[model samples]
Target: MTSTAPAAGAATSGATSTGTSTATSSSLSTTINPTFRAPTPRHSSFTLSTISLCGQPEDVLDLQRGSYALWRDRVEMKLAIYQVLDHVISDVANPADPEWLSLDFIIKGWIYDLITPELRTAVSSPGATARTIWVAIETLFRNNGLARAMMLSDEFRNTKQLENPLSVYIGKLKAISDEHRDLGYPLETHALLLQLVCGLHERHETIGKYIQTEAATLDLLRLRGGQALHG
Candidate 1:
């Protein structure tokens, strides 16, 4: 009762302290800031390094003999590149398109791996298109034409089926035969059949004996063999 109403100065001081606290809180809420970061940029032209291709081009068996080695290596590389570019082979509309650029990049990566340093320098040129590179490779390798074809033919002829099925052996023979035909030398259907028969592994000797008779058709040979196996 003695001090309750007499402390006006103390009441004023308490009011000032509360007001200062409120103002400090308001100042912090208004003045605090947030930071922002910028996004990363991307490259314009499609670019890739050489590690993508699994292996170097297979050397032509004749590489040790003479100039034919160059052709064989290039042909081997061409086949590999064809496989790599199989999807885009049909996409031939615009060279300036991004898809084309991507194809060019892939061709480069595989090519870089396929070629040795010497060949790379020989073929490298500024602003070279993919088609140009293809042409250059073909031109370089096609030098020893008939000799290369003969080598492929010899390999095809000697390709006897050791332990594989007729289908597998025939498939291998067919690939060699196709390349053989591309070089302007073709075997008759009967000749191919004979090769098929002669190359069979000893397990299929019964089927071989059946097909060895005169006037045997490839269709009939497969039919009789399948029936014999299943029956």
Candidate 2:
């Protein structure tokens, strides 16, 4: 005689021996283009509040772990920021509005200030694993877009020092792109690849101040795409 048992991969329909119930199983579907929803605006001091709770250096590690988990789980936050910025740069309709560009700059400035130099040094150190580098690259890309915007803005011309990290960040971005390529992943994983390449090319002349390249302007043009560059 055959015993009554749920088939493999199927959930029990009713009460179990332990007075527990099971829900029916369904096939799981996966997709590359996950649907992204916008996140609701949180209190502007949310990051600060989280940091404040971590009162000491030892607590900072725990805070970072918790923060990383939150960032990873909150798809809406990533979508509203990085996904929206990606569309803006690609000139997608509705998503490419200039107002969003301004908001991006403002948000980036806040984020950049929040990332202390100590944090940057820690993230970029030789001990940093691939996952650490990936997270840092994501943070930099989200902020570097605003740096590029500031570099192009007339008001920022008077405040050149504020724009210094744009090139340094690009270098780090290129390094991350190279790492992704070496790992045999598609270039799309390095979401800011196109922007980094273009930004490097556009600022090749001035970038020498930050990164001393022996290659001349003509050589730099040849190295990158051989065309007039625009920031």
Candidate 3:
């Protein structure tokens, strides 16, 4: 009986130590699990550089040979599709915004790539916005006058299918007509159809006669469909 109290005290001390260890372990587990937080599950970001435009435009801007109207239409449509048309058409963001500046730089470089080396220098200036470059290029190519209209009209009438494919020949005529119209001298649809037929090669005589015969009923759309079939 001499050591009974000591043994009981020892057992009580052991039980208390076990309980404290269990409590401490539980506290540490709660703290560590919460702190881990599954590593916050990082998410990637989207930016203009990540965007894909599918491909560059088919037509490059050449004042002497390229159709400005066609090139503009294609380029603008592409920008609109990618939701970046405002970069070239309007100021959609703050000038000081870093993100907008990056996008603008990218678009400016793209515009420069699409034009001839000479036109690039003529349109671009120090710290110029995309809209400024766009307007400058447009002014260079689309300045309308009686002299330009007459020159395009002559080119339109003189176009011949010859060895060129019908599609290409029609494209030339349409481009000339578009430029002439931009000069406030729109040709009549019937007259355009006649010129389209007149420029056809002898091999296309049958279709040309058909177009001439049905001139009143056939529209440009139908004429283009016929061209695709026979092109």
The lDDT for every candidate, in the order shown, is 0.58, 0.37, 0.75
Task: Check candidate 1 and list the clashing pairs.
Answer: none
Question: Which stretches in model 2 have alpha-carbon errors above 4 Å?
Answer: 1-67, 74-98, 113-116, 120-231
1 or 2, greater by TM-score: 1
Mind giving the per-residue lDDT tens digits that candidate 3 earns over 28-131?
99888855564432112145556444354455677666567778888899777656788888856567976677777777777887888889988889989888
Q: Give the CA lDDT, 0 to 100, for residue 135 in model 3.
A: 91
Pairs that collide, model 2: none
What are the RMSD figures for all models against the true structure? 14.1, 19.3, 10.8
Q: Model 2 Cα displacement at 129 (Å)? A: 24
Better of 1 and 2 by lDDT: 1
Leading candidate by TM-score? 3
For TM-score, candidate 2 versus 3, the one ahead is 3
Per-residue lDDT of model 2, residues 14-54, tens digit only: 34522331222211222233664456654332342233222
In model 3, where is the ten-residue run with the lowest total lDDT?
A: 38-47
Q: Estimate each model's TM-score.
A: 0.48, 0.20, 0.65
Error of 3 at 228 (Å): 12
- In angstroms, give how far residue 222 of model 3 lies from its true place: 1.4
lDDT (0-100) at residue 100 of candidate 2? 48
